[model samples]
Target: MKITVRQEKAIDFEDITLLNDIAFGQEHEGLLVERLRKKTPFVKALSRVAVFENSIVGHILFYPVKIVNELTEYESLALAPMSVIPELQNMEIGSQLVKDGLETAKNLGFKSVIVLGHKDFYPRFGFSPAVNWKIKAPFEVPDEVFMAIELLPGGLMAVSGTVLYPIEFNM
Candidate 1:
């Protein structure tokens, strides 16, 4: 199996949307991703595709998320709505995408990363509850559902209160 990761381009938009449908059964996460891209132009497309002999079959996106308290603003990241084609589910493509996103985020100087996802899956990447960093989502979620990984020491230090998503997230 030969697989590669690359930055997404405008041309890949249609194939990527199709791949997302096959991965998640039509337009759910696609909306979020597209909305983010339109609204958060600064988002990094550390996003990747697993090309298996030509057809695009997997995808992921990373976006800017922030922790805002009365006196502080911390730049962080959010991993939302990742999906792989159902047929590709067990093939480690999702794992590769997550690992690639995290590694790229670290190398780019992002301090902390947050994800609202499967508690069981994310911990494999060292994600702990955001509460550990005194951070909470605007909406109430179980402690484990909101997870974070601090890429640097004190990355989340003294960071507390609501975690705000980009306005485009619509959440």
Candidate 2:
């Protein structure tokens, strides 16, 4: 099946929410997406959807977040709540969304991205443990599940601190 990945449109909101709800078996992720859209850090171009046969089957969002210490704050993108409908799982719809989203982020000048995801799945896209760069999640998480990918060489070289997600993420 051919899947088309594109930036989300206003008309796709409900479909994206439903897709996230079904994929995750809950409304929390859907709500998070909605909340993030209203926040200052939301990057509309980075919220994307995978379309199969004219229907949205997958969604991915990359929101701006900060990595900071006493001296400075580095901006980065956070990949969260990516999802594909259950019937389409493993069909590479999610993969397509990720690949397209990351490229869009890089083109938009984002230096790096952070994701709390499956260790095995994300590595193929060049993601590795964020700990390697001395980055920490605001909350406790296993090292391997929290990963980062540098969109540009030395993207994270000068960055090392705890990530500060938006308030919407904490809800």
- On lDDT, the candidate that comes out on top is 2
lDDT by residue (57-87, candidate 1, tens digit) is 7788878877888897788888876777787
Candidate 1 residue 132 Cα shift, in angstroms, is 0.7
Superposing every Cα of model 1 onto the true structure, what RMSD results?
Answer: 1.7
> For model 2, which pairs clash?
none
Per-residue C-alpha lDDT of model 2 across residues 1-171, encoded as one tens digit per residue: 988999999999999989889999999999999999988968899999999899999999999999998899999999998999999999888888899998999999999999999999999999999999999999999999999999999999979999999988789
lDDT, residue 15, model 2: 96
Best of the candidates, TM-score: 2
| Candidate 1 lDDT for residue 82 | 78
Error of 1 at 82 (Å): 0.7
Superposed by TM-score, candidate 2 places the C-alpha of residue 146 at a distance from the truth, in angstroms, of: 0.8
RMSD of each: 1.7, 0.7
